[model samples]
Structure formats: structure tokens, C-alpha cells
Target chain A: MNLYELTIGEAHGLLSRKEISAVELTRAVLARITEKDEKIGAYITVTEASALKQAALADERIAGGDMTPLTGIPLAIKDLICTKDIKTTCASAILENFIPPYDAAVMEKLNRAGAVLLGKANMDEFAMGSSTENSGFKITRNPWDPGRVPGGSSGGSAAAVAADLCLGSLGSDTGGSIRQPASHCGVVGMKPTYGRVSRFGLVAFASSLDQIGPLTKTVSDCALMMNAISGYDNRDSTSVPREVPDYTQSLTQGLKEVTIGIPRQYFETDGLDPSVFLAVQKAVKTLQDRGATLVDVSLPHTSYAVAVYYIVAPAEASSNLARYDGVKYGARDKTQSSLLGMYRQTRSKGFGKEVQRRIILGTYALSSGYYEAYYNKASQVRTLIMEDFNTAFKTCDVLLSPVTPSPAFKFGEKREDPLALYLSDIYTISANLAGIPGMSVPCGFSQEGLPVGLQILGPHFNETMLLKVAYNFEQATDFHKAKPVF
Target chain B: MKITREEVIHVARLARLELDETDIETFSHQIGTILEYFDTLNQVDTQGVKPTSHAIFLTNAFREDEIKPHLDREKAMANAPEKENGYFLVPRVIG
Candidate 1:
């Protein structure tokens, strides 16, 4: 196999045995990025100089026999995460020139693990949209089909992993940013329980909904990344105080006696493409044939998830995004004369149209007269959505569903219709609403040959069970092994 | 509920964003359509259900009143669009 095609686990084995040097691996991946990323547009920045330096240090550590699983592994970071001295644009022109002075808690962990940073991946501007078309820089194409999108917000991260531009990548999920794209790109993408991972320095979109997680070629690599990135951090007030498990150790080869719930509402939802339904159904049957029991479950509130998410996410976003006024950091508008004018012009020129729309929607929702009617009502209904999941989990260990209603769609398909784009996330938004760990694994392909994702969801902080279920499913199929021929 | 063009402009003002007339009209129609879908929430009788700001309940996380080293002055000012004398430059507020 080519060096660029090795998974994190395989590379670790080779690195430990001195069969390949860190610099060699890093160069191979960088060469792949140079060759393919121009057509794919998967990255905003590629740090060739800094990456080689880091690889040299990682090689020194491996030579000293002080290596970790991620040592010398080239990984891409979704541009939202803060990396010290590196430009962390959340795919917005507002922060296009902004470089953070500190590393995010997750970046600190990755740095300590001796991982090599490939560069910043492209994303939806401030993670506001479901597709990377919202990116301020360039649109990322699906490696499988150049005419299609690679999913959103974390589209670049998913596309990078899918195209073998990097071994693994980190992405933040608010709504279905990570999983939806991971599904579209045919890789393993996970979003941990809301507070299971720290959010400090994560360039907040919706403070209550965002969580950083991993996108990798296999479930085991996803688990290895989970072990590295998940833990408690006092820097973030919402990070849960819980025991961090060795997620890779939880990858058992059995699904015996496990009860998997099939949320009936997801299957019956309007606009669910027939091909996606069949693929997900086939995946569930594969699980049942392997000794797991499938139970029909109801999450009646599922229908309201998209509505509640639109209100709640935008409400938080308006407040969180109010910080960018061309004052402290980011690009400033020089033509404005007055203070308020600067704020208006800087934001108007910097933020994209979808971003502007959300800011307005959020502002209206939280405005004086509309607060109780829109924002408050949405939050109250959010509780009902959570309770639905809690009640369903009472009878099943995990819930199985489709990641998105359809396989990857062609670009400009839903670009003009905002509501159509929002409706596509119906299946995956409930997990974020309930603050549960959710993941998307490649299960089957549609008639168009685009990948389909099987979504597995577990209650809060129940990542071990979700990973085990995904790991077992991955072992049963060669779907994860199928790579996009670049 | 239908979002009017005037309301869209008003909300844009509150968000400190300057939208052209074309954008205001487009947003008014789009936001109105989305808010119409959100009206589905009003049907669910959440009479006494408490509003949840977060999925999991967390309280004020306090630590010992401690001080740690913070970002150096140079690094903090590095990304400022306009900076002078180790401080960010903003529009004049008073005559």
C-alpha cells in the first residue's frame, strides 16, 4: 500500500518498527495534498514548513522510544479549532487574517500526543450551514464524485480523510456538521456528548450544541482519536467531570444481546430517498443477523427537532457572534466613520449571506418582544426532545437511523432553498439536541454509487457503547476499507 | 408569522449588519418561511415545561481565586486590524 493510504493504526505499527520515518510519512501526505487538493479544495491552508519541523521532532521522540499512537501521524484540523500562532479561520472572511494566540484544549492534547499538523481544513463559514458551499474560501468537492458536495461545516475534514489527504482529522459538530459530511464522504465521523469534549477556543457557533470530534478512515482510528481528544478541562465550564475511558479498549468484537432501537419516525419522514432507506435497512438486518435484537421504537418529538434546532442554534449564535465588531481581532472595515458604522460595515462585508441570515433570525428571536414566543418556546420544546430520547433509551442500548435523508447531492441543489437544506438534517439533529454521542459509519452505497451512512446514537457520555457497535458493524462489512480513487 | 421587510431591516440593525434592499427582501421571505415551520412548536402544549438552555445540567464551576500567566501583549495585539501603543484602535467615541 502507498504511504498516503495507511490508516493511523497501520502507520503506528510501521513507525514503531522503524520501517518508515515520520518525515517520510509527512512528506508523502503533503505530496498527496499538493497533487489532489487543488481539484478537491479541501484545505484553507497547508503548513508545509511547520509540518516538516513537527515531523522531525516526532521522529526524534520515536527514536527516544517515547512515542504515542498518534506520534508523527499527519492530521488535519477543522479551521475552527484554535492553534497557537496558526491562522484559524472558521471559513469566514471576518476572521480570515486572525491567528489565535493560544491553543485550544484539544489542540494542546494533540500536540502532547506528538501528532503532526497537516494544516487547516475548510468549513462552512462559522459552521452555520450544512454544506461547505457556505465556505468563504472555496467549495470542497466530494472525492467520490467531483460534481457533488462533500457535506458541510466539516466538509473539508471529511473530504481530506476520504481522499487520503490525511490519516485522520478533527471536526466540530453543531447540528449535523460532522456526521452528515462523514456520511457523504464515506468515512467514520463522531460527535461526542456535548460536554464530553471541551469547547474552549472552538470559535463558538451555537454554544449549547457544538462538540469537537474525530473523522477517520476506520472505527478503530476514530476510537484512537477519541482517547486522545476526550477528557475534562476546567477551561471550559460545560466540560463534564467524568472518567475518560480508553476508547480503543472498548472495541469488542461482539454485539451479543445488544438491543438496537430503530426510531420509526426517521424512516417515515417525508422526502427520505428510497435508496438511502434500503441501505440503512440492510445495515440493520446485518446487525440482527449478527445476534443483535432490533426493536421498533418511537421518538414522536423527532418531527420537531429541525424546527427547535433552527431557533435554538441561531439564538445562541447571535449572542456568541456579537464579539466580532472589528475591534480586538479579525478584519476591520476602514471606510466607516463612526463606531456603530464600523460594526455594521465590518460585519456586513465580512460575514457571508447565510451567516447574515442566521444572525438576523437569531436577533429577531432574542429581540425584546419575540423572546418568549420564539427563543424561549424553542428551549422549552428542546426539553421535550431530550425526554423523548431518554425514554427511548430506557428500552434499548442504542438507536439506529440514517445519517441524512439522501446520499450526497450535487452542488447548487439546495443552495437557493434554505429550508430544504435544513430539512436534510432531520435524522441527525436530535442527537445534538439531547446531548448524546452520535456517529456515522459507512454502511452501503446508493444507486448513484454515493456512500450511505448508518447513524448510531447513545445517551450522554455513552461513547463506549456507540464505538463498540460501530466497530462490530465495521468488521462485518468492507465499506470502511473502500477508498475514493483520486 | 410573516416577517416583513421593515422587521428584517430592524433585526439587521440590531445585529449590526448592513443589508441592501435586495437582501432585506430576500431575508424577509426566507426568515418568514422558516418561522412558519417553527410555528409547529406553538402547537405542542409546553404549558409548564421549563426551558432548558443546555442538554446537561451544569452549575457555576468555581475554582480557587487564582491567577495564571495570560497572553503576552504582543501576541494578543498581533491580529488587531488597527493597533498602536499595544492596544486595539477603534473609532472615536467622544468629541
Candidate 2:
């Protein structure tokens, strides 16, 4: 196997045995990025020099017998996460030149684990869109088919992992940003329960819904990553003060006692592609054959998830994004004389059309006279949606569904229709709303050869159960083994 | 549910974003469509449902009043568009 194609586990084995040097592995991955990123557009910035330097230090740590599982593992970070001294653009022009003064909480953990940072992966501008097309930088293409989108917000991280540009990558999920793209790119992506991972230094989109997780080549690699990044930090008050179990410990074989809930509403969702439905059904049968019981469940509010998410996410985004007035950091309109003019011009010019739309939508929702009708109304519905999950989880250990309603769509397919794009996240948005852990594991491929992902969702802070189910399915199927022939 | 150009412009102003005539038209139509979709929520009878501002419930996370290491003046000012005397300089707010 090519050095760049090695999973984090495989590379660790090789590195520990001295079969491959850390520099050699990092150089191979960097070379792969240099070769493929131009066509894939998976990165906003490629930190070659810093990566090599980190790799050298990782080698020293390994030589001194002070290595963790991630030691010397080269990975890509979604651009939204802050990395000290590195340009963390969040794929927006406003912060195009903004370099953070401090590392994000997750970055501090990864750095301590001796993980090598390859670069900042591209993402949706402010993580506002379902397609990376909203990026102020570049659109990331699916490695499976260059004509299709890799999926948004975390598209670059998913594409980099799929194309072997990096062994594993970190992607943030606000509304299926990580899982959708991981599904599109044919990789394993997990969005841990909200607050299960710290959000400190994560460029906030919707503060209440956002969670940082991992996109990896395999389920076990995803487990390894979750172990390293999940923890509470006082800096982020929302981060839960709870024990994070070793996620890999849950990767046992059979699903004998596991009961997977199949939400009937999801299968009945309009526009769910037949191919996706078939693939997920086959995966359900595979689990059943593996000694798992399938229960028909109903999350009645599933239909309203897209509606509630649109209102709530945008409302939060508008408030959180108000910080970018170009006074302290990011782009400023020097031509404007008055403070108000500068604020208006800098934001108008810095933000893309989609971002501007969300800001307006959010501001309008929270505006006077409309707050009761829009934001507050949506929040109430959000409660109903959360209750739906709470009711369903009572009958099952985890819920199974399609990560996305369809396989990766071609670019420009739904670019003009914002509502259509929002509906694409229908299957995955409820997990964010309920603050439950959700993951996308490659199940099978469409007739078009695009990958389909089976989504496994568990109750809050129940990542171990989610991993066990996903790990068992991954072992039963070879769909994850099928890589895009880039 | 139909948002007018005037409403879009007003919301844009509230958001501190300056939009062109074309942007106003586009956003008005698009935002109107999205709001129309949001109308679905009104169908659910949420008479007494409490609003969920956060997913996972947690109390206010308070830390002891203690001074810890923080970013120094130089580092904080490094990304500032304009700065002088360790303070970020913005456009004149008053005459």
C-alpha cells in the first residue's frame, strides 16, 4: 500500500516498528496533497514546513518512547478550527488573512498527542451551506467523481481523507456538515454528542448545534480520533464535564444484544433516492443477519427538523457572526470613513451571498415583532424534535438511517435552490437538534458508483454504542474498503 | 410569508450588511421562500412547549475568580487591521 493510503492505525504500527520514519510518512501525504489538491480543491492552506517540523518532533517523541496512538499521524483540520499562527480562514474572505493567536482546545489536545498538522481543509463559508460551493476560497470536489460535490462545510476534510491526501482529518458538524460529506466522500465521520467535544476556538456557526468530530478512512480510526479529541475544557462552558471512555473499547464484534431503530419517517421522506434506500435496507439486513434486532420506530417530528434547523441555526449564526465587524481582526474596509460605513462595507464585501442571506434571515427572525413568530416558534418545535428522539431511543440502543437522502449530487444541481439544499440534510439534522451522537459509515455504492453511508445515532454521550454498531457493520461489509480510484 | 425588498433591506441594515439593488431583490425572494418553508412549524400545536436554546442541558459553568496566563498585547494586536498603543483602532465612532 502507498504510504499516504495507510490508516492511522497502520501508520502507527509501521512508525513504531521503525519500518517508516515520521518524516517519510508526512512527506508522502504532503506530496499527495500537492498532486491532488489542485483538482480536488480540498485545502485552503497547506502547511508543508510546519508539518515537516512537527513530524520531526513526533519522531523524537516516538524515539523517546513517549508516543500515543496519534503520534506522527498526519491529518487535515477543517479550516474553521483555530490553529495558532496558521491562517484559520473558515473558508471565508473576511478571515482570509486572519491567523489565530492561540490554538483551539482540540488543537492543543492533538498537538499534545504529537499529531502532525498537514494543513487547513476548505469548508463552506462560515459553514453556512450544504455544499462547499458557498466557500469564499474554492469548491471541494468528490474524489469519487470530480463532477460531484464532496459535501459541505467539512467537504475538504472528507475529500482529503477519501483521496488519500491525508490519513485522517477533523471535520466539524453543525448540521450534517461532517457526516454528509463523509458519506459523499466514502469515509467514516462521527459527530459526537453536543458538548461531548469542546467547541473552544471553533469558528461558531450555530453555537448550540455545533460539534467537532473526526472523518477517518475507517471506523477504528474514527474511534482513535474520538479518544484524542473528546474532553471538557473550562474555556468552552458548554463542553460537558463528563468522563470520555476509550471509544475503541466498544469496537467488539457481534451485535447480539443490539436493537437498531429504523425511523419510519426517514424511509418515507420525499426525494429519498431509491439507491440510498436500497443500500441502507441491505445494511439493515446485514445487521439482522449479524444477530441484531430491528425495530420500526417513528420520530414524528422528523419532517419538521429542516424547518426548525433553518430558523434556529440561522438565528444563532446571526448573533454569533456579529463579532466580525473588521475592528479587531479579519478584513476591513479602509475606504469607508464612518464607523457604521466601515462595518457595513467590510461585512457586505467580506461575506458571500449565502452568508449574507443567513445573516439577514437570522436578524429578521430575531428582529422585533417577528421574534415570537420565528425564532421562539422554531425553538419550541426544536423541543418537539428532541422529544421525538427521546421517545424513539427508549425502544432501541441506536437508530439507523441514511446519512443523506441521496448520494453526492453534481455541483450546481441545487445551487440556485436554497430550500432544496437544506432538505438534503433531513436525515442527519435531528441528531444535532437532539444533541445525540450520530455517525456515517460507508454501507454501499449507488449504481452511479457513488458511496452511500449508513447513519447510526445513539443517545447523548453514548458514543460507545454508536461505535460498536458501526464497527460491527464495517467488519461485516467491505464497502469502506472500496476507495475512490483517484 | 412573502418578504418584500424593503424588509430585506431593513434586515440587511440590522445585520450591518450593505447590499446592492440586485442583492436586495435576490435575498428578498430567497428569504421569502425560506420563511414560507418555516411556516410548517406553525402546524404543530406547541402551546406550552418550552424552548430549547441548547441541546444538552447544563448549568452556568463558573470558574473561580483567578487570573491565568493570557495572550499578551503583541499577539492580540497581531491580527488587528489597525492598532496603536496596544489598542485596536476602528473608524471614528464620534466627531
lDDT (tens digit, per residue) of candidate 2 on B6-91: 89988899899999999988888889999999888888999989999999999999889999999988998899999999889988
- Model 1, stretches more than 4 Å misplaced? none
- lDDT score, candidate 2, position A262: 94
DockQ of candidate 1, scored on C-alphas against the true complex (2 decimals): 0.89
| Chain A TM-score compared with the true chain A, each model in order | 0.99, 0.99
Error of 1 at B5 (Å): 0.8
Interface RMSD of 1: 0.7
Least well predicted 10-residue stretch by lDDT in candidate 1 chain A: A248-257
Q: Residue A270's C-alpha lDDT in candidate 1?
A: 90
Consecutive 10-residue window with the lowest summed lDDT within model 2 chain A? A247-256
Clashes per candidate, residues 3 or more apart or on different chains = 0, 0
Q: Write the per-residue lDDT of candidate 2 for residues A29-58, one digit (tens) a residue.
A: 999988888999999999999999999999
- Summarize candidate 1's per-residue lDDT along B1-95 as a digit string, tens digits: 48988899888999999999889888988999999988998889999999888998898898988888897898788888998898788999885
Global CA lDDT of candidate 2, please? Answer: 0.93
What CAPRI class is candidate 2? high
